[model samples]
Target: MKRVLITVFAAFIALTAAAQSPIVQAHLEPSHGILVGQPIRMVVTVYVPNYFTGSPDFPEFEIENAIVVLPQDRPANSNTQIDGVRYAGITETYVIYPQQAGDFHLPREQVTVPFALAPPKSTIAQVPLPALAFHADVPAAARDLDYFLPTTALTMQQKWSSPMKNLRVGDTIERTVTVTATKMQSMLIPPLSLDAPSGIRVYPEEPVIHDQKTDRGDFVYGRRTQTAKYVIQKEGDYTLPSIELKWWNLSSHRLVTATLPAVHFIAAANTNYVTELPPESEPAPIAPIRHRSLWKQYRSRILITSLCCIAVALLLAMIWYWLPRARRRLQAWQERRRHSEATYFHNLQRACTQNNAAESYVWLLKWIAVADPGVSLQQALKRADNPLLTSDTNDLGESLFAQRIQDYSWNGKRFAALLRQQRKDHRMHLSKHQYLNDLNPK
Candidate 1:
C-alpha cells in the first residue's frame, strides 16, 4: 500500500513537470552595433519558469516606436524555431539605413504583446524585456577640387515620354527621369542642368522622392523621379547628348557616375497649298482686229473694271460681319468639351491610385459610361483590366480593400497608405510637367 502511494505521488510530479517544462527568453547582438541604416534582430528562448507548463506557439511582439537622429531606413524581418526551444525560441530583425553619417541610438522603448498562453490565461505579466541599443552610421561628404567627379557608387536612371511624339513646329515634348538607389546621400547627387538644343525650350519637372526602404540593417534603397517639357521651334531631326549623373557610393568608398544614352527627335515641315490655273494647252490664237474706234474700246474696259471693284467690296463687307461670330462659337465649344473630359480623367486617376476597391469600381463604371454609356458596374467588372476588381459575389466589392472588421468602409491605414502613394505618384507625374503649378501657400 505504501509503494502504491509513492507511485501516485511520482506520477503527479511528472505531470506537473510536463506542464511547465519550457520558458521564453530574448536577446540581440553587439547592442552598440553600427548600421548605416536601421537594423533589428531578435533572439527567442523558451523558459518554463520551473513550474509553468505546455508551451504554445511563440508570442508576437512589436516595437512601439523608434527614433534615430541619424538618417536610416527601417524595416522588420522575423524567423522562428531559430535558436530553438522545443516549445519556442524565435528571432526578428529590423534594419535601418542612415542617410547622414553620424551617431544615433535606439532609445529605451516599449515592446507590447497580446498573445494566447499555453492554457490561455489572461494578463499574466512577465518581466519587461530590456531594450537593446543600436548605433547608425551616416554619409560622408567629399571635398574635391573638381566637383564633377562622383565619390560614391550611387547610380541614376531616366524615363521619358512626349505627349506629341511627332510634332510640327511650335509643338511641345515631355521628358522624364527616374533615379533609384540603395546607398546614396542626396548631397552626393549633383544638381541637374540641361543644355537644350538651339530652337528648343526646356522646362523642368519637379523632382520627387517617391519611396524608401532599408535592408539587412545597413543599406537604404529609394526612388526619385522628375519630368521636363520642351517646345520645338524648327523642322529637323535634333539630337540631345547623353546626360551625366554623379553620386558617391559609401559602400564602395569611391566616386561613381552614370550617363544616360543620347536622345534624338524630329519636327515636320509646315506646307501651304494654293490654288492656281494650269498653263494654257496652246497659245491663244491671234484675234482678228476688230474694226472698232479707240473710244469704244476705252469705254468697254472702264465699265468692266468698275463692276469688278464693286463685287470685291461686297464680299469683304460680308466676311467682316460674320467672322468674329463664328470664331467665338468655335472657342466656346472647345472649352466646354475640354472641361468635361479633364474632370473625369483627373477623378478616375485619383480613384485608381487610391485603390478603394469599391469606390474604384463605382468610379470605373462611371468612366466607362462616359465613354460608352452602356456598361453597368456588374458588366464593367467583368471587363475591367485591373486585377484588384473581383468577380466573387461573396466578396462583392471587397477584394482589394484591406481586410477589416465588419467593414462597411476600407481599412483606414490601407486607404491612407494607398492615398499617400497615389498623391505622391500624381505629384511626380505632375512634376513631369515643369513650372506647371506649385500649390505652395507662400
Candidate 2:
C-alpha cells in the first residue's frame, strides 16, 4: 500500500511539471540604444513545441513619455530549427518613440497561449514574457542647433498659383511652399511664418503634412506644404518678406537653410470701378388749404382703414393657431418619407439612371443602413437571405471597380421591389404587435 501511494504522488508531480513547462520566449531586439524622439522597433517572438491553434494575447503598454506605434502590416509567421530543436514561431513588430531623454523601462508582458497540450487535450498556458528596456539620449551634434530635424535629405521650393506682377488693389496673391524630407516623419516639421507690409491682408491656410512610403514598406519621404493668401487692400509698392526654414542636415553633418527670396511689386487701384452718390435736392413747400373740408372727405377713409385692420388681426390670429399644427404635420410627413425604404430605392434608381455610380453607391449604403441600422452592407445583405438582392448588391460592389461609368449599371429594379416588400412586411408586423398590445393592455 505504501509503494502504491508513492507511485500516485510521483505521477501527480510529473503532470504539474509538464503543465508549467516553458513553451514560448520573448525578446527585444537592438534593445539598448536609441536617441530621444527617435523611433525604435520592438519584436516579440513566440515558440511552441507542438503546434499553436490560437493567437496569443498581446497586452499594450502605457509607459510614461513613451508611445508604441503598431504597424499596419500583419505579423510574420515562420517555422525554424535551431540546434535540432523544431519550433513554430510568430513575430510581431512595433515601433516605440521616446519623448524625453532618459532610460525607459517596460514591464514584463504576460500572454495566454492556446495550444494543443496533447492530442484531444487542448489547453491554454499563461506565460510571462521578459521585460523591455532601452536608453535614449540627445544627439551630440544636434544639441546646439535649438531646432532639430533628422533626415537623410531635405528640399524646399516656392510655388505661385498666379503671377505676382502687375498687382492691383483687391487682387489676391497666393504663395505656396513645399518641403520634402527623406527618411523622416512629417509631424516633426515646423510651421512657417509669413510677414507682409502694412495695408496687405494675409490669410494663412492650414498646413498639410504627409509621409510617403516606398513599395518595400519603408518610409521614403515626409512632405509638408504651407499656403498663404495675401489680398492687396491698399495700392502701394510692397515688399513680401523672405522666408527661411532651418533644419539639421543629416547628410552634411551640419545645419542648413532653405531660403526664398523677397518679392517686390507695385499695386495700383482700378479706376474703372467707381461708386456714384445721389445728388441732394430741396424739399417742396406745403400749401395751406381748407382743413374742415379735408376732414369731411377723409372720414370714410378712416372707417375703411379700421375695418381692414380688424380683418388683418383676425387673419393673423388664425395663422398663429394653425401654423404650429401645419409645421408638425409637415415634419411628420418628412420624417416618414426619410425613413422609408421606398424613398431610398427611388433615389438610387434615379442616380443609376443618371449614370452616377458614386451617388448610387451612397444611396445603396443608405438604404442598407436604414434596413439594418448597425449592420454593414455585406452583413445586411447576408441577413436579407434573398439571393436576388444579394447578387444585385455584389454586382453593384463589382461595378465600383469598373473604370468607366458606362460599364456599371445597377439593373436591380427587382431588388428595389423586394426591399419595398420587406418594409411593408415589417410595418404589418409592427401593426399586429400594436393591436395585440391594445387588446391585452400589458
Candidate 3:
C-alpha cells in the first residue's frame, strides 16, 4: 500500500509539469516557389498543456525588402493532444509581400504567454519563435517592367462629367479614371497620366486610394480613383492622350497592359466673345482737354470749407443756449432723487441683504428720516405699528451697538422680509389718508 501511494503521487507531479510546458511553432505557408510582389502567409501557433488564462502577446517583426500585414482578426483556437496530454492552442496569421527578388528571412523572437497549469493556478511562460526563410524571384515575362504589381485580377474604367460633343470656349469637362484590383494594396497602384493636347488646359486633382474588406476582415479588393478637369481655352479640335498601365497578373503568370482609349472633342467659337480691337481699325477721336477757372478748380474745397464753418457756428450757438438749461435740469433731478423715500428704502434693503449690521443700522435711520422728516427710528417704527419690523430693527441695532461676544453672528433674511412688509403697510395707510382728504377737501 505504501509503494502504490508513492507511485501515484510521482505520476501526478509528472503530469502537472508536462501540462504547464508551452510550445511555439512558426512556418511560411508555401516554403517553395515565390514571385516578387506576391503575398505569402506566415502562421504562428502557440500551444499550452492545459488552458490559457490570458491572451498571448505576439511579437511584431519585419523582414528586409518586404511588407508585413497582420489582420485585425481574432486568434484561432484549437484543442489537441501532445504526448498523451491535453493541450490548448492559439493560431495567428501574418501576410508578407516581397518587394524585390531576393532571399527574405524572419528572425527568431520571443512571445509572452499566460496559461494555467491547473484550475486557479496560472503562470506566464516566454516561448521563442522558430526562424523562417523564403525566396522570391521575378518571372521571365515581367522582367522588363519598371513597376511590378502582382495581383489575381485588375480592371479599369473611365467616365466624363459632361458630354464631349458641341463643347464651347471656356467650357470645362472633368474626366475620372478608377482602377481596381484584388490581392493588392491600393497604395501600390500608380497614378495615371491625363495630359491634354494644346488649346485645352488640364487641372489634375489629388488621387484617392482606399481598400475594401468583407465583414470577416478578408481583403476584397483595392481601388484607386483619379480626376482631372479640362478647360477649353481656344476653339479647336483636341485629343487627350491615352493612358496605359502595365502589371503582372498572378492568375495567368504573364505581364498585362491595361489601356484607356484616347478621347477626341471639338470646341466651337463663342459668338458673344469680345477681344481687343486691331490697330488697322480707325481710332476714336480723343476727347478735348478743357481748361477751368480758379473758382471751378477749387469749387469742391470752397463748398466744404463754407459748410464746415456754418456747422461750427450752429454747434456753438446750440451749446451756449442749452448748457444752462441742461445744468439746471440735472441739478433738479439730483435733488429729487436725494430726497426720495424710495431711494433711501432701497439702500436700506441692500445693506440688510448684504448682512452688514452697522451699514444696515445707518441706512435704517436715514430711511426713517426720509419717510417722516424729523422723526427718530424708534418713533417711525412705533408709528408704523409693525411689531415684527420693530423687533427685527431692535435686534439689528443690538447686533451693531450692544456689547456681545466676539463670535456672535447675525442673519438679515428675516429682517429684510419684515422691513418690506412694514414699508408696504405704511404706503397703504398714507394712500388711504390722502384719498379721504381729497373727498373731504379740508
Candidate 4:
C-alpha cells in the first residue's frame, strides 16, 4: 500500500510540472539604444492554458538610476489556439526613462499566479512562472542634447481676442499660446518662453494641459495652453518677440522648429487725458537768528541718547534673527534623542524574543546608554534594586557565561516581563515629577 501511494504522489508531481505551467516572456520595445530621459517600454506576457481561470499578478519594478512608472493603461487580453491547445494570455507594459548614459539591465523575476482548473472554479493553485529580463543602453548620442524627447509631431500657435495694433496706455490685451504634440506626454514638453518688449507689463496665468487619445485608443496627443494678460505701460511702439520650440521629429529623423509669429503694435497716449499742476505760491523770506551756545549745551546729551537707542535696536535685531533658529535646533535635538531611546528599547525586546543572550545583553547596555548616558546596564539594575529584575538579569548572565558544562537556559519571557514592569514604574515616577514641576516651574 505504501509503494502504491508513493507512485501516485510522483505521478501527481509530474502532471503539475508538465501540464499546469504557464508560458512567460518579456521584451523591450524599440529594443536598441535610446537617448537619456527618453522613455522605453517593457512588456511582460503570461500565457496560460484555457483550463486555468483568472489572471496573473504582475510584479512592480523599481530600477536604480532610472525612473520606472507603471502604465495607467489597462493590460491587453486575448485568447488563441496553438497546436490544437487553447490558451489565454495578458500583456502588461511599463514605461522607464533612463537618467544616466550607461548600460542598464532589468533583472528577471519569478511570479506566482493563482488560477482554478475545474468547473465552477472553486479549487485554486499557485504556479510559479519563468523569469524574464531586458537590457538597454544610452549611447553617446544622448550626450549631444541637454534635453531630448522623441515625438512624432509638434505644433504651436498663438491666438488673441483682438489684434495687437494701435493700443493706448493702460489698455489690456489677453493672448493665448497653445502647443500640441502627437505621441508624447504633455509633461515632457518644455515650458514656452515669450519675451516681452520694454514698456509692456505681462501677467501670466497657469498653463492648462490636456491629454487625449484616438477613438480606437491607439494614438495619444497632448495639448498645453499658456495665457497671458499684457497691459500697456508707457505709450510707445512695441513688438512681441517671436517664440520657437525645437523638438526631434521621429518620422523625419531630424530636429524641427515650431514657430509663433512676432507681433508689433503702437500704444498711443489717450487724447482726452488731463494733467494737473500744483498751485503756485510765493514764500516770505525769514530773518536769520541763531543761539550757538544753546545748541552746543544739549548736543552732547542728544548724541549719548541716540547712541544708546542704536545699541538697543541692534540687540533686538540680533535676537529677532537668531531666536527662532536656536529654538528649531533645540527641537531637532530633542526629537533625535527621543527617537534613539525608542529604537534602543525596541531592539532590546526583539533580541530577548530571539533568545540570543549576547545580543540581549548588548541591546540592554545600549538602551541604558541612550536613556541615561551616565549609567551602565549593570549599574542601573543595581540602582533599581528590584528583586524580579535582578534575578532575571543574573539568570541571563549565567546562561551567557556559565562554567559547568554550559548547561544554562535563558528565561527570555520572565526577563522581558520584569523589564516592562520596571519601565512602567519608572515612567509613572517620572510623570509625577514632571506634573509637579509643571505646576510650579522655577
Which candidate number has the best TM-score?
Answer: 3
Clashes of 2: 0
Q: Which ten residues in a row have the lowest lDDT in candidate 1?
A: 70-79
For all candidates in order, the CA lDDT equals 0.48, 0.69, 0.79, 0.69
Model 3 per-residue lDDT tens digits across residues 247-358: 8888888789999898888899987644334347688899998987989899999999999999999999999999999999999999889758888778778878988765
Separate clash counts for every candidate: 42, 0, 0, 0
lDDT of 4 by residue, 1-442 (tens): 9999999999999876456456677777767756555567777767665432333556666888777766442556554565555555667777776765567777555555533343323223444334433444333343365556567878898888787776898788998999888866676677887668888878899999887754433328778899999977778878888998877776766777788888888899976533333456798788797657865889999899999999999999999999999999999998787558788788778778777666576567557766766554455777788987887887765654343336665677677777788888888999999999999999
- Compute the lDDT for candidate 4: 0.69
TM-score of 2: 0.53
Query: What digit string (tens of lDDT, one per residue) describes model 2 on residues 177-256?
Result: 98888866677777778879998989999999998865434456789999999988788989988988777665565667
Candidates sorted by TM-score, best first = 3, 2, 4, 1
Error of 2 at 304 (Å): 34
Would you estimate the TM-scores of all the predictions? 0.36, 0.53, 0.56, 0.50
Instruction: State in Å the error of residue 348, model 1.
Output: 37
How far does residue 373 in candidate 2 sit from its true spot (Å)?
28
Worst 10 residues of 3 by lDDT: 400-409
In candidate 3, the residue pairs with backbone N, CA or C atoms under 3 Å apart (3 or more residues apart, or in different chains) clash, namely: none
Best by lDDT: 3
